[model samples]
Target: MTDLLMNPTVARLTSRSLLGRKRTLLLSLLPLALLSLCTLARILGSLDDDIAGQLQGSLSADLLSTFGFAIMMPLLGLIAGTGSIGPEIDEGSIVYLLAKPLNRYTIVVTKLLVAIGVVTAFGALPVLAAGVILTGELGEIAVAFAIGAFAAGVGYAAVFLLLAVITRNAVVVGLIYALIWESLVGGLVPGAQTLSIQQWATAIIEKTLGYEAQLLFVESAVDFSTGLLALVGVTLVATAYAGRRLQTIRLHDES
Candidate 1:
């Protein structure tokens, strides 16, 4: 666990790179947008009951599911996970590190920690705050979405990190998974829904919230056990495979 959580130098480098200006801007926009929308939701919910009804209906379905889980986590996961190694590979710097006497497993785990750390920070906090504001309540739905977003972020970091290891087009692939597979197909196709991270996270939220939360539109297509199993299994498999793939990764000579 100690070895798995971090390595000082690697963590520092990943943190600096992941939180650089452009990426910082992207991350900042998300939380700001979520919070702003949440605040407006609260005001509107207070002004009139009808608009409040509309906002409440969309709160769980659109804001929590669509924005937080589908959009935020995967996008953050892709940027952090792939950006950890993608730029180094693109500029021919990865060869220097690849030739070093570091354990491949340690390197992979270190990057993963950095990725998951950033994802949790950016993904979970805003969702929790937004859920609370959107509903003007706590515990019932807010806490549930917070935990779901964090879990989904963790699982997403592992999967996208593996994609970074396997392909240069990892970002493009991740977007397709985030948008097309999870968003487009998962809604229309029953088989695809079973494998979706969003649904798994929703299952978590559904189970976490108290019974009174049924009034909210916190719909989930999968069982809690199945969702839990899928999220954990995918994270472990992706991380293990990424470590193995890292061993075989061929760094081109900069010359």
Candidate 2:
């Protein structure tokens, strides 16, 4: 189990490389923007009686859901996911790493763990903070979105990490999936929502919020069961495939 699950060496190296100066700045940017927007909204709501009521009602929910869940979480997942192993593969450093006496699955799982941790810290925490700042309390609205962000973060990390393993153009493909497919098409097309990590998160948020979700108008194209199943299935399948792909990777020097 230990051999298949994680390696401290891989985890340490992946963390140091993934969270390097430039990538750290990039990861911090979205969270900073989220907190800034929440702070600004809090200030604006304070200045207006009607807006304050709305913030307590739905505006806060919209901000947390739309920007935090729909935008920031996926973006963070992409950066953390690809950064975990993409550079190593690209620069042929993966050859050295692979030459070690380690299971390929162990490497994938360790990197995936690091990616999930990064997303939890930079993605889920910010969403939670933004929700509290916007709503002025750690209520259902705040907690629900935070949980949803974490769930979505996990799914995105796995999926994007698989992309990195399979393609050098992981960033381009991930951006199109995040920006165009998930954000754009998922918004307009009803069927696409069922296939989206965003909507799966919405289902999670709705489930977590429960009756309060209705009050806040939280709705998802898919039900909680479908969403939960899809999230788990994708994460497992992607991680497994990535491990298999890594096992078969043809190193430049080997060729």
Q: Please provide TM-scores, in order, for all candidate models, with all chains considered together.
A: 0.91, 0.97
Query: In candidate 2, which residue ranges exceed 4 Å CA deviation?
Result: 253-255
What is the Cα-based TM-score of model 1? 0.91
Give each model's whole-structure lDDT: 0.80, 0.91
On the 0 to 100 scale, the lDDT of residue 251 in model 2 is 56
- Cα-lDDT of candidate 1: 0.80
Error of 1 at 248 (Å): 1.1
Cα displacement (angstroms), candidate 2, residue 206, comes to 0.2
RMSD to the true structure for each prediction, in A, is 2.4, 1.6
Q: lDDT tens digits, residues 133-220, model 2? A: 9889988888899999999999999999999999889999999999898888886699788899999989999999888888888899
Worst 10 residues of 2 by lDDT: 246-255
